[model samples]
Target: MAPKITVIGTGYLGATHAAAMAELGFEVLGLDVVPEKIEMLAAGRVPMYEPGLEELLARHVAGLPGSTGRLRFTMDFAEVAEFGDVHFVCVNTPQKHNEYACDMSYVDAAFDSLAPLLTRPALVVGKSTVPVGSADRLARRLAELAPAGGDVELAWNPEFLREGFAVQDTLHPDRIVVGVREAGGSAEKLLREVYATPVAEGSPLVVTDFPTAELVKTAANSFLATKISFINAMAEVCEAAGGDVVKLAEAIGHDERIGAKFLRAGIGFGGGCLPKDIRAFMARAGELGADQALTFLREVDSINMRRRGHMVELAREAVGGSFLGKRVAVLGATFKPDSDDVRDSPALNVAGQVHLQGGQVTVYDPKGMDNARQVFPTLAYAASAAAAVAGADVVLHLTEWREFRELDPAELAGTVSVPLILDGRNALDAERWRAAGWTYRAMGRPRA
Candidate 1:
């Protein structure tokens, strides 16, 4: 029989992790403090928009594969401690209020609640991205709290799944990194068992000490954020040099060393992960008294943020400065395409900025309008891009949704008050849009 696994905190990470574990043929129990979340998950409903997650949940939650004992959801920590052989702490560590430091309260609460219930020997794995010392602290806490005392082993296993590709990333991860104490245990073997399918499919597994594992996640996010800011910073230089940033990026991408994955020169990155992770990483570095080592991230963050201000400036320039009464249409709201999560979304931030500057901003997103409204309630939301662009002075293509890309420029030109467009994602076809009698503008491109 497979080991019984319990996944705590059923947000995006926990939800996908729990589902993937069940699909891996484990008797999985998912626990959350929120009763509504557990109730919803138990009934085969996902609270957010992630592709393929809902279908996977529905399939497993209906009946546990040939038997009725498949995936289970509960709010009780005691029940989880009794059932699970390996418990995964998958809680979120979001940024604190008005600071770059991560709020570790949720992670602490998970350990506080579940540690006392461990009556016997069990493995506790942390999948959340945390500071370097978190795993060491939790290991000591588990030793003191669990009835099994020193028998409870702790491991750090950080997740690298992006929001849009959470399910796929979890089921078929790029690599697995596990950090354990010097005493050592069967964590690697158990994790190997848990991820047999992916391992067989050619995913590498890395094992190391606690700090290295913790550093890997923050380092990865920081690199990604740096890549994005690097391109956006080039976009600024391109604007001054009257050169094309897209062509520059394409040229640099041919080097193989500077691969063109996150070279998108747009309004910059903002989601639940990149922005917060980089900030938290910087904060952690400061706390560790090695602030000089990570000081460059400050510029990376500033460059990314400056792109938003650049978009607003472009918008102002398009409408002859000072948007006192201009009608502006924003094409998308979510940070990126394919996901409806709007935490620190750049598109919505631009919309709000434009609205605050007296521009009548009408925003439209295929899926992010509801979430965007929840965050920016004062901004005008339209049912469709056509509705948003109706009688608009300028159109801002902020988020690169496929629906927005597929939109006919000629059709939009006919409806809008003006045919001027600012492509924030650099996704629009220049020749096609220009041929349609619309003035097309994009970031990192020579002005036409």
Candidate 2:
């Protein structure tokens, strides 16, 4: 018989994981403390916008018409402990307020709530991104708290899901890694069976010790953050020298060794993962007394943060020195396109900065308006791009949504008070905007 799966915590990671598990032919029960989120998911509605996630959820969530009915959700931990043989703890590990360390309070709470109710042999798999050596401590805690102390074992399996591409990433992962305390333990056997579908579909399964598994997530995020900052650093150099960073990136990306995935030079990276992961990694290294080895990550972080401020400066320059009383329209608010997540979003940061500088900033995003309003409530918001740019002195294209790319520069030019526009993401077509009687300016590109 196949092991029943339970996902603890139904936020972005947990909701996607639970839906994906159901798609893979497992009976999945997802638990969350938030009543509204649980109510939403139970009705086959995703709380936030992720491409294709709601449609995917609709196909599998229990009550929807023509659904598989394999997935169910609840707020009760007792029901979760009774129903699942394999529990995946997919709680968020956000950065602690005013500190570089990762906040493990959610992970701790999930374990505390579920451990004592484990009256049978089960595998508790941790899929949350955590500091290294956390699995060992959590394993000890589980043994101490659970009634079936020896029967309940722990496994560390950190997730690598990107916000926008979460569904595809989960269903067809590049690789599946599990960290086990004992070599060839029952935890390994059970996880193998749980992931047999993906394994059969050519995803490599790497079995390793706990520390390496945890490090894989942070190290990978740190490297990706470095790659983004490295290119943005080149953009800064390109701007000073009047050179095009796009051409530079394109030429360098031709080398097979340096593939062109995260090389897009823009307003830098921000969302739920990259920024916090690198900082937490640095903090963890400091705790383990290996801080110097990863000290360059500080510079990587610095470069990324500098890009956001640089965009703000560019906006001010476009509006003639100061933003005092200028009607500035921001074209996007989310960190990136295709998702509604605005946590640590660079676009919103720029919008907020411009707003603070007395620019009458009206922000618009296809899906991020609600979340953006919550984060930066005082900033002006608009229902559409045309509405945002109406009578605007200058416009800033901060997020590179496909809809923004599809927008007609001619139509937009007619709405703005001034025809000046700044492409923060470097994603817009400069020639088209320029031809439409708008001054198109972008970082690291020659002025037209």
Candidate 3:
């Protein structure tokens, strides 16, 4: 028989994981501390805008028409403990306030709340991207607090879900990694059974110890941050030498070792994961007396942040060197495209900077308007791309949404006061924009 699964803290990671687990034919109960999240998710509605998440929820969340009746949500810890055979702790570990350390309060709280209630044996799997050494520490604590003691085992199974592609990624993961203390024990056996479908479907199972599993997520994010900053650093050099960073990235990306992923030179990476994870990784390294090993990440972070300032300067230049009276149009609000998460978003950062510097800024995003507005309520938001760019002196395309790429540049050309566009993502078509009588400028490319 399949193990009944319970997911704690139904945020992006938890909610999606719960729904995906139900999709895999398991009886799943999801729990969150927030009543509102439970209420919303119980009704098959998502608070966040993730593509395919709501549809997936509606298909399985209990009480909905023609549903599988396999998924339910609640806010009670005892109910979760009694119901689930395997519990997944999916709480967030956000960065500490004004510090580089990870704030593990949520993870700690979820574990504390559930561990005391586990009177029976259960496998608690952590899927949050936390600092290294967290899993071992939590495991020891879990054993101490739970009445089941040795029977209540804890394992680390870090999530690698991308924002826009979370649903597909969860259901058809590229790999399934589980970190267990005893490799062939019941904990590992249970995990193997829980993920048997995906593992059997060809997603490789990487069975390692706790620290390695905990490090995978932070390490992957740091490496990605480095790759993105490396190209942006090249963009800086290209700007000085009158060379094209786009073409240069293409030339370098042809080397199979470097590959073409995360090579696009733009305003740099931002969202909930990369920035906080790298910072927390660095902070944890310092605690372990290996700070020098990850010291290079500081420069990588600097380069990434500098790109946002560069875009603001470029936008100011496009409007004649001052933003005092200029009407600026920001084409995107979320950090990247296809999701509504605006946490530490470069697009909103750039838009905020422009607004602070006295530009009458207007922002637009297909799905991120509400989240962006929550973070940056002062900035003007528009309903559409055309509405955003209307009567603006300069436009900044910060997020590379496919909607922005598919826009009719010829139609937009006649709308703005001055036909100027700065492509922060470097994903736009130059020929089309130029042919439409609009000035197209991107980082590291020669001016037209």
What's the lDDT of the predicted structure labeled candidate 1?
0.90
Whichever of 1 and 2 has more TM-score, that candidate is 2
RMSD of 2: 1.0
Q: After superposition, how far is residue 420 of candidate 2 from its true place, in Å?
A: 1.3
Q: Stretches of candidate 2 above 4 Å error? A: none
Q: In model 2, how large is the Cα lDDT of residue 143?
A: 99
Segments of candidate 1 deviating more than 4 angstroms: 62-69, 182-184
lDDT agreement with native, every candidate: 0.90, 0.94, 0.94
Rank order (by TM-score, best first): 3, 2, 1
What does candidate 1's lDDT look like per residue over 1-448, in tens digits? 7889999999999999998888888889999989889888988888888999987887677444543347889899999999999999999999999999999999999999999999987889999989889899989999988988987889899999988788899889999898988524587777778888998999998889999999999999999999999999998899899999999999999888999888879999999988989899999899999999999999999998989988999999999988999999999999988889888888988999999999999999998878998999989899988999999999999999889889998888899888999999998898899999899999889978
Highest TM-score scorer: 3
TM for every model, in the order presented, reads 0.98, 0.98, 0.99
What is candidate 2's lDDT per residue for 56-91, written digit by digit as tens?
999999888999999999999999999999999999
Clashing pairs in 1: none
